[model samples]
Target: MGIHDLPHALAVHLFFTLSSVVIGLVLGVTLGILLSRKPKLSNVVLPILSVFNTVPGIVFIGLLLLIWGMEAITVLVALGIYATFPILKNTYAGLISVNPQYIEAAKGCGMSQTQQLFRVELPLALPTIIGGLRMSTVYTVSWAVLASMIGQGGLGEFIYAGISANDNGLILLGAIPAAVLAFVLGSLVDLLQTYTVPKGLRKRGSTK
Candidate 1:
């Protein structure tokens, strides 16, 4: 392809990355919260998730491709599943890590279980959850390149073409933008972590 194709390719790449990440974030956080309420179930489920997480993105995508037959859904499902793991694991860890004192304090105030989760636990856990989002966003951007394998259209087109043609320049065209996109998104997540941190925690950190 030529330089002119870059804009469309980039747009397609963004669609795949953002859509899958959104799907993953919602599913991961929801499952994490539900599992957090049942530590025993989490013990079984989380270990299974970790095993699945060990699978490579390319292999995951290829398996989905066989089932879905080269559709965009195939790519989205593969990418979304990959994106879900980090967010789910981190959200679970963050929720469970909340200090017992906080839980006790909330209970002392007669706070409902739901209120304690929303008002206390979730706010405190936001930083760790955002960290998972950062991981998912960056990894999804890289994995979005696999879209080209099924002719779904993305920066990967340039990457695969470059490899076949033995042209490093073409490969860089895809790679550079992907790296920059991941950096920009990851930085945004960092900003989110900063603002979402509880004021008490911030004060404690500042004093130290």
Candidate 2:
């Protein structure tokens, strides 16, 4: 492929990465909140999800393809699930890690459970939760390339086509952009942490 084709491929790559990350983030954060509220659920749910995480990306995609067929939904769902684990773990940890003192303080202020969660807990958890998002985004960028294996077409098209043709330039063209894209997206997430995290916790880490 030439420079002209790169734009279309990049769009496809972004679609695969962004769509998956968005779904994963929402689901993960919601699940995390539930797990924190009912810690016992983690004992049952986490291990099962962990098993899914351990599965190789390609194998997972292939399995999903059997059910969803060689369709875009298959790739989106596979990549989204792949992206969910870290965020879910971090969100739960961040929420539960809040100090008892803080919880008591909020309660003393007459803040209800939901009020405490939104105004105090989630704000404090921002740093760690943002870190999870960064991880998920970077990983999905690499994984999204797998979209091409099933004909969805992303940078993987170049990578795989280059491999078959033994063309180093084509391989580098694909690999470099993907690596750069991952780094750029990760950096953006870093910038986001400053704005997302509570100002109080910016310097002093959140306590347990």
Candidate 3:
């Protein structure tokens, strides 16, 4: 079936992908900010996140299945876990990369703590954060395919059926759209960076 005919499948994929990205971003950024404020936490959290990142995606899904037993929630939770590390690492890196002098200047200008975060720190860190978000998006979309193993409808259904039935055309139908979706998402993120990044930062090659 074409993607249009599989609206529930599409919606499931979209929900899983979007929810993973958003949750990953929120958790990642929050933890990243906390780490920046407390370098001692880095010795603890960074290693843990790194270990999680090293775990294979399928293994994570399998563990989730063992706990949740083939539910839709298992799919989302697995995908979300897979989506998190990149955003977390990158957000921490971005915030840390901000020059001390720039922060001092903001303080010199009497910017409040909230104002400094929103206007100075976040704007400066946006490119890196977005880059992490792009990575999470691709990861989430790809991982959502595994949801079909648990009886959730997605493009993976076509892939699984195609493989079982030896239908090359059906396999291509799923593979093609998945590839296109990833490409489109990556390109859209690039476009966002181009337009949304501060002009000076873009000119300085910091936005890329």
Candidate 4:
């Protein structure tokens, strides 16, 4: 493959990564919030999510293929599952880690539950929540490449094709770009955390 083909492969990787991360973040954050409000439910739900996290990525891919066949949905579902745990776990931690004093003060001021969540808790938890999203993005991007095994082209296609053809240059072409992409994206997440986090929280090293 030429340098021109590299962009196409990179686009595939980006598409899968972005799709899976968005879906995973929405589901994970929503579930995390719901679970945080109901600790008893978390007792049952967190463990299941933890198990999903523990499952090997390759095995998860195999399971997806078995259920969904060798389709794009298999790759999307597998990547989404892989991306879910970090966001969910981090969101829960962030919510639970909120200062009881602040919550109590909000309650004393007669803030409604919705107001407390939107105005106080979520703002305070924003940094940690973003941290989870960063982790999920990195993980999703890296793994989405593997979807090429099922004919969904990405950087992994280059790596796999290179291996089959015994072309080190081709492998390096794919590998180097992927690593660079991950670094750039991770840095962007850090930049976002730096700017979006509250000033006091940023000072405490929680944001940056």
- Of models 2 and 3, which has the larger TM-score? 2
TM-score of each: 0.95, 0.96, 0.90, 0.94
* TM-score, cand. 4 vs. native: 0.94
Error of 4 at 27 (Å): 1.0
In model 4, pairs of residues that clash are: none
Maximum-TM-score candidate: 2
lDDT of 4 by residue, 74-190 (tens): 998889878888998888889888989999999999999999998888888898899999999988888987898888889998898889999999898889988988888888889
Q: Which stretches in model 1 have alpha-carbon errors above 4 Å?
A: 203-208
What C-alpha lDDT do the candidate models reach, one value each?
Answer: 0.90, 0.91, 0.82, 0.87
lDDT of candidate model 4 versus the reference: 0.87
Error of 1 at 80 (Å): 0.8
In the range 122-161, model 1's lDDT, one tens digit per residue, is 8877777888999999999999999999999999999999
For 162-190, candidate 2 gives per-residue lDDT tens digits of 99999999998899999999999999998
Candidate number that wins on lDDT, 1 or 2: 2
